[model samples]
Target: MTDTTAAPRLSVRTLVLMAVPALLIGIGSAVVLRALDLVSEQLMHFLWDWLPGQFGADESTPWWIFLILTLTGAAVGAIVWLVPGHGGPDSATTELGGPPPKLGAVPTILLVAILGLAGGVSLGPENPTIAVNSALAVAVFGRLSTKIPPALLVMLAVSGTIGALFGTPVAAALIFTGTVGALALPGSLWDKLFLPLAAAGAGAVTMLLLGGESISFTLEPMGAIQPIYLLQGFLIAAVSAILGIVAAFLFPYLHKAFHALRNPIIFTTIGGMILGVLGIIGGPITLFKGLEQTAELLEHPEDYSASQLALFTGVKIVALLIAASAGFRGGRIFPAVFVGTAFGLLAFALFPGIPISLAVACGVMGITLAATKDGWIGIFVGIALCGDITVLPLLCLIILPVWLIVTKAPELTVHPPEKAPAAAPAKA
Candidate 1:
């Protein structure tokens, strides 16, 4: 039987017509994303700023961080235990751009995402936003037109959400290439991507209009490529990639360890306590998703000694591992970027003569590549964070060897074992 939900060879006319809904989806994605960010930002201020100040203690103090994170975890666990949809699929177990999530789970997922973000969990907003947008898009579009397959709608929603997240349609194209490339569609690659691209472009533009900020920094551009610097970039990227691979390899085991606690509330609460210790050890710099912290690290590299930078890198990696594993709902990319940034900055602080921007960009590229397992995004974000187009050619060449090692590593997601089937009835 022909499944009505399966994607067919969409005609050019049908594809073009789909753009209208795609555009709407993109706009809606941006709106929801913006709303979530704003709400999270406000709550973050309340928890990390207003409340701490009212109590006359610095928010970054060890005791305060410990209390907040532990409590946040307990609250989130309670939500997962009692809330509708159980906070959606655990972020640790799902791949970005994989299956469409249930629409009913959207609110709880967003709530936990907001808590994690505002509570200083070492994670990002990508997975949750994509999940919610994809869920809503599928539900709305499915009702509007049964002819459009759920996959098509999900692709559009993911493209739109990624575009908004990164503030560029280009990111949507590059990161999505591997996933979309496998479809044996009738059109050329670009033809296959046309509608999604439209949605991405719309989402980017909407985000820009809504005052989205791009990750950027001021650094002297790399001079004409130096042969010596090639080796330098390769070293930085390779080392950072190795760290990412280690975390990826450890993900599933850590997930099992956390789940062995046998209760969502208990495991999450314990995870929060561990994260608090990491925050105290790494200081305030290693908390959150690392976007703002990455900027801060770059703006004043001198403030962090090489040892402190090393601590930041190591702590951030561990924090990310625990946060993802212990049932926290968030993305891994931003924290990975933070780890790369600190490691890169540490290299510069120690050596003093290497091009600082190159070190940072290469470091970011390597880790992002390993973390995402996507070469295009790694290069793009490395360039994005460094804000230097001149580093692009060098990053391109440097990622080759690093990619080889990284390709064999497991993804930074978990695969919990399946349970045995129930016993057959004894009475016959």
Candidate 2:
């Protein structure tokens, strides 16, 4: 069976011609991602650091966390209400590589993304980075050549952004495998992938050159994988995925509830208050996108009790949902990663028998798969977190049951119901 959607096949020559453009797009993507990060970082320092010190308040205090988050929500809500583009569409209704926003909306999208990130919103930069890069790349490069279709340009830019965001082209390739597989163009998959990979590689290299951080963390070398580790991995991952499934089920309802307030400011402000409370409960560790926190967990596992790890896991899941449900503009991956890490650590702490690497890897694999419905990234992040190839074979098996679990469950996104066409007048 094959897809019937007809797409023009590109010759190797055309693909070769586009490779340079793809490479350029990749560089641009990395630059955009790094620029957003830099601006967000500076703003984060001001909001969380400089502002707190002036009042003789520590950022870790509940009052400060509550104040910062509430202010952020108000700020974002004001922009969404007043900004010309309204920060593009509702981010809760979007997905990674889903659709690009209008060119005019790119600036607003990037703006809100930075706001959410620096405001300690529990989300990542993936979706906005891709959204902005794809929009700009297509609008800019579409005029430069007719041979390259806009769709491919979107692909090239998305791949580049993914590469830069993850600090590796390999991550981009793994992520796009399903996308290419679903395309109807006739060619070897590699042929179809040529330009995108070029873009991804270029973007990855640019990010590396620009000192972008990576997602990888080193786990103490656990011994070779035992047969029992597979079962343990599956169990841990399954539990995590089940929790993710709960979030998936609640996603739409939560989104609907938040938007019920109508005005973005009111709903987002309330959401921020909820997140601030969650932050106080989970402490500073639960704030931000989860990369640095995840690394912190691995580096200092002894610092947290099992109950504390569990609290972190649960609080993060709620925070992610609220941040996502409310109109905060960002991706879910990083927050999910943090949740998965806490779950893994909690599992290891409780069992004491499961290998730390296996537990963490499976936890990441399960939760990510359920959270995003993307197994490739689940596997990529699971292995990347532990830096253990030993767990790869087991993650492959663990994903099977996890997929079944999420197969029928709703995806963690919302879709606005389509309006019925207006009835035409029967009388002339």
Candidate 3:
């Protein structure tokens, strides 16, 4: 007797149905993002507290920071250069609707992120984390032979990513859902809305399992609020908004700088040199990664001398620009936040009477400006960076004028000006 066997098939209905469980899975994955956040935080703590002590490196010694800086620059450089598809998703583009890079690039991105962050590169783990999330999703589905829709998979992946990076599953879900909602899809609007919500719910669940916690910032204002203080706040916010636009305008140009360099080792090595020079001029605070540094700055505002803080702020921005120009793989978010916080700190130094809460607001505006090209999106970033969701309405009010002023600043566009059609040919 002969036996016949048939390969399993997936119908459109089956594929659509898969989205339900996928949403459930995505909620679970959000919890995973939280766990990853804990892991990364612990890793950062280990590096700062135990790793350096174990290796006999001390903060007082400039040499340790130098070694960290150079090695970090070199290691991340090598990883990006040697890795296929070069250093993960470009978060600059990805957050604004760029196509996801190949799933094959995941391992390389993970390795680069680990080494770079561990080595003290002034970058965030969000981009690499997102890459890994997508890759894992694809891998998991492939292994299970599941017939989940690709769109659903993407939703779950990004939801987990936002959950992990933000440590706020609700915000992550809302943002992811809102962003996806903005896109054009083949399915009904209900389906589009449903898929992202499902994924976000699952991602939040996953984040909880991964040990992620929501964080809040306590504001200790310098003194009683006054209209004058609000004016100062407006000024600071305006400045940061302009700066943010400038950074956005610079990104495309910076992209060109790296492309023009054309040699990975040379580009990155030279970037390291520039960073070293900037760090030496700026001081230890500006050397190596940014987010933790921003938190530290907030926690101990008195530790850094005014001049030192100012220098660090400038150097951080310069270093970030050079790093991107040199082809380093990292997200611009943390660096932007660091720079913004420094500016806020600087404002406090200048106007000693200003409330610290307002100062933080200024910093939030600055980060908002730089982190996103859209004013609406900047509202969310400002709220997120402030470490307080409650401040969003006030922030919205503050950001509105700042956004208007800065939006007209003529440099907020992410892409460089198109070369005027090559002079259209004196076509005669």
Task: Order candidates by TM-score, high to low.
Answer: 2, 1, 3
List model 1 lDDT by residue over 240-296, tens digit each.
999999999988999999999979999999999999999889888898989899999
Can you tell me which runs of candidate 3 are displaced by over 4 Å? 1-56, 89-97, 138-152, 173-178, 182-194, 213-215, 221-230, 287-289, 384-391, 408-428
Query: Candidate 3's error at 428, in angstroms?
Result: 40
| Model 1, runs deviating above 4 Å | 1-12, 423-428
lDDT: worst 10-residue window of model 3: 409-418
Q: Sorted by lDDT, highest first, which candidate order results?
A: 2, 1, 3
Estimate, for each residue in 32-110, the C-alpha lDDT of model 2 and write its tens digit: 9999999999999998889899998887989999988988898888888888888887778887777678899988999
lDDT of 3 by residue, 165-235 (tens): 55555655455544665544445444555655556656655565565543335556344445575577778
Which 10-residue window of candidate 2 scores lowest in summed lDDT? 419-428
- Could you list the CA RMSD of all candidates, in the order they appear? 4.6, 3.9, 8.8
Per-candidate clashes, comma-separated? 0, 0, 21
How far in Å is the alpha carbon of 214 misplaced in model 3? 4.2
